[model samples]
Target chain A: MIQQKIPGKPVTVTINGKKYRANEGEILLSVAIREKIEIPHLCFEASLDPYGACRLCMVEVVRKGKREMATSCTLRAADGLEVLTDTPEIEKHRSILFELYLAEAPKSDVIRDMAAHYGVTRTRFLKRIEQGDPLGNKCVLCGLCVRACSEIMGAGAINFINRGPYTVVNTPYYAPSRDCFGCGACVRVCPTNAIEMEDVGADRVMKSWSDTRVPLSQCECCGRYYAPRELSASVLARLDTPLKEEIARLCPECRGKQLAQNEILAGRGGRATHG
Target chain B: MDERTLDAIIARHDAPAGRLLGILGEIQNQEGYVPRETLELLSEKLGVRLSQLYGLATFYSYFTLRPVGDHVITVCMGTACHVKGAVAILEALEGLLGIKSDVTDDGKLSVTTIDRKFTVEIARCFGACSMAPVLRIDGNLYGYATPEDLPVILGEYGWTP
Candidate 1:
């Protein structure tokens, strides 16, 4: 087994004139938050991987006589670097970043809460049209769910397919599969709650995660929700036997009908069984 | 209240919650960030609480509550950009700016490393996959960016190393 290298000894870095020691590879934002620095962030959730999508943790770092903006969640602490957490300029850009998020997902309560904290009562851009008002629902497309699934769950079940404004996340060919364990992690991490799952039958359901809805179906014999409709069809089509018809006919109601017909053909099944 | 200032503040105060963000954007453009005093004036004029005003300002990413520099540099750290050494580019920028991603320099240059920006956030694939690593200064796209290219890019924006 390849041994993972342990981070170097902790080093002291000054943030907003307050000095703190941080271990190597531990993000500055996490360290600051641990120390109650209150660095604003949206996409850096401890439960999930740090995406740095919200751009709210932007901070000023002075190192080796050079200064630049760095994401606190992604930036590792370096010795002798001076950091400023709440400068006037940082507040201004953070306000703007929040405004952009509002433009992308205006109705989100999470965004509203963050904005309230920062004192932004207005924005300069056009208001985002509400869903069904030509603009549709507010999904900023942070891809948090997509990353969480692949990185943490080890299920490459969902991915972004298509391009530009029309892009959406889905399984390949817009079909559900056994690869999806129905964990619902995608639904949890979605910033906008755009993806929805609805129960269609016993252990069977439909997922409206994107534009195209995928219907998940259960196996009639085993009563197990095996795969989505599109996936089942594609798989059975490749099989030589009449598995597709067998699947359709294996339901309790269909099986009962078949049994009655078979008995009637033998002249031994009649009104008693029918009733 | 001066006629022009009152009108500007009143118009912002009277705007709808959704439209309020846009109005605030205009105010920032005019005054170089949402002034705290202007926020107070708006709160009183619009009959909104200061807390409500702060809520709105902090809710969106585009509205600035404080002053910003003359030029803004936004680096993309989207998935495509990340796989293409966007982190290294951001580190190089940090070295050049003497400040971190969301902080502006004393010289008035605001640098931000955004995962996504504008209406077209880095939420989805940027479709500039061919460009690999990309950065935007004032909404202009730069592809195949490198640490070596930082000076030239900053120089074009009147930023001297």
Candidate 2:
């Protein structure tokens, strides 16, 4: 069993006049959320590293007669620090951030959830034109896929490229990457349904977090979907050098069948005969 | 407007998180960094404490405690950039400037080393992946960079080789 580290020292902090003790170095937001303090957050995930990009976890912290607004995910507990999870200023900032995210990626359920919770339905900003969305704007630019790929999976198959306003995540050469493991971790972490799994009979097409099409494959045996076309081809190439026709003809099950038939024909037929 | 008026405006208006970041960003833009005094004033007017304010400021990578230089040099360390030897280029810059990421040179050139910048930050693939090892000085993008090109790029920016 993998050992999990329990915090050695516990620290005391006050939230809205209520005192709570938590482990040192633990994120203030996670502990507050666990304690049911109703701290608003949008870009934080327990499974992944804290990305303060969304700026939703802003809180008021009072320490030694000083007060300031900060993101709870990246801050640690300090002795005698007083925290306020909700205030008009914090609420206002969170609402506007949600609006900006909405203007960019209006169709995200995660954004919708935060909007509903925060009582934000409309704003003064004009509705942004859905630039890349074929169906509609869905991606919120949360960086989950990038973090999962680089930090968790250890395969830097994809990443954000370019600078402001025109940045995009892509493989090297804009061609299919050789490093992807077909894990679909990016697809799973997307906040917007912009990234989709398209099942095309024998193939699986993956839409990017921003709705760019990344064609994947469907296993022939169970018809389960896999990763991008280039990734699948590379994986198959590593195992054996099969002609395209041969590969197309054999799914996992059919390939197993071909191997069994070849074995039987090679005088390993005794097992078949017994059966 | 004076500090009192600025504090009054922050207190009177009910700004959301994005607007707050924008407001704080504006303050940073004006002052070159978010002053501790400004944060304290915001907290007192907004009824929040100092620790909470510091938490928000430190949480996002964009907010900086120290002053930055006039020009910002951001080197892309994304996978494509890395594969094409972005590390070497970054090392060259560090060697030349005697500074690291998030630090400005004594001459006031702020250099930030990031894997990705905003906008294209959420891109599934950088379309210019063909141009591996890219760098962006301010907003201008350069591609297919080598260690040899570093001196030329810096020299163009008035940095001697």
Candidate 3:
């Protein structure tokens, strides 16, 4: 009897005419990308589950003489699965899809980069007229920011509203959401850089996030600003016990230096006691 | 919707209609649309990601996160329907609602009105191309619907003018 998917085992997959070893059940998009195989994709985040929204990471899979198109992000890597990344058929569809995205946000640098990569000179589809700057990054509605907010940060502040051409990410009831923590996780994970968050010395302002502004934690060591105070406190408060939860108000670099100094002091103390 | 009711609906999944789709279908039936609270409850109960739940919710036209009016009116915007004056029908409905082609204040077409009386939405197709320019009010299909008939049709649902 043939064994199917031994748990906790690695598998070999053939990608772009090359053999590569991958963890069983790993997303094919990540495996392809990790192996240096370029498959132009959007709507994929390392912190979120495989969402088959963008459909740009399409790859032709040949299994036992049957060929089919599958979104690499949603499909898992399996043993003996032959994946062709850059076939003309796949490239053709990617160009058409990118054109649609270009038509939406023509001036977006990320979209332009993809267009340049695919050699898309112009879009065939008509762009929708919306009130905003053409050169500013626009939401392609890939939902990465939404996922990062919900899945990664547990902040379900924003979600998809409307459908079809009018679909967009907005706070609940189209108002400023109470769930946003000012952590900037959504801004950091946004693929198109459509979201912008700024740390203004002592306060953080996220314009796209319903004008969210929160206080920043200053590093005790050097007076440099670090994480958002509310976000840090919220995360620290989520610990199992409520016994005096405290977060060190220090920058990462300062924290690292302090940790090393303490280790050296502890080592010298132990040597003195032992000697 | 209460959390206990949602838990009960989730427990009622069977071979035919007990899966996520079936459970969501049941929720949609009870609430006229999928509520965010219900969605969050289901996500919490099932340990599923919110994005995945939202992806499924947005993928289907029947499932809506926003509240819907007592009566939902959908106009077919398919190619066949579009060519046969569906745009005019949608425009008329928008005029009546003071919104653009079923679009809500948030630019979303599926949102309910302030009073929750009527919700206007655009459908991809009803699969009845023969009856081009079709519209549906509360699941009842109307064929060859014209812009002039908007008031009379809405009047049937106790909507005056």
- Candidate achieving the largest lDDT: 3
Candidate 1: tens digits of C-alpha lDDT, residues A1-275 = 11115866788889988889877666788789889998887667666656677788999887776777888987877776688988888888988887887776676666777787898756676666543421134566677766776676654456654434344455543444434545566777776665666555544342543333355566565565545565556656877565456665365455566667867866853433322
Tens-place lDDT per residue, model 2, A72-142, is 98877777768887778788888898778777666677677778778887656665554554325665566
Candidate of highest DockQ: 3
Local lDDT at A187 for model 1:
71
> What ranking emerges by lDDT with the best candidate at the front?
3, 1, 2
Number of the top-ranking candidate, with TM-score as the measure: 3
Error of 3 at A20 (Å): 2.2
Candidate scoring better on lDDT of 1 and 2: 1
What DockQ class does candidate 1 belong to? incorrect
Per-chain TM-score of candidate 2, chain B: 0.68
User: Candidate 3: where is the Cα deviation over 4 Å?
Assistant: A1-7, A133-137, A238-247, A256-275, B1-161
Considering DockQ, which of the candidate structures 2 and 3 is the better prediction for this target?
A: 3
Candidate 3: residue pairs that collide = B13-B18, B14-B18
RMSD, candidate 1, Å? 24.2
How is the predicted docking of candidate 2 categorized under the CAPRI scheme?
incorrect
How accurate locally, in lDDT, is each candidate?
Answer: 0.64, 0.63, 0.78
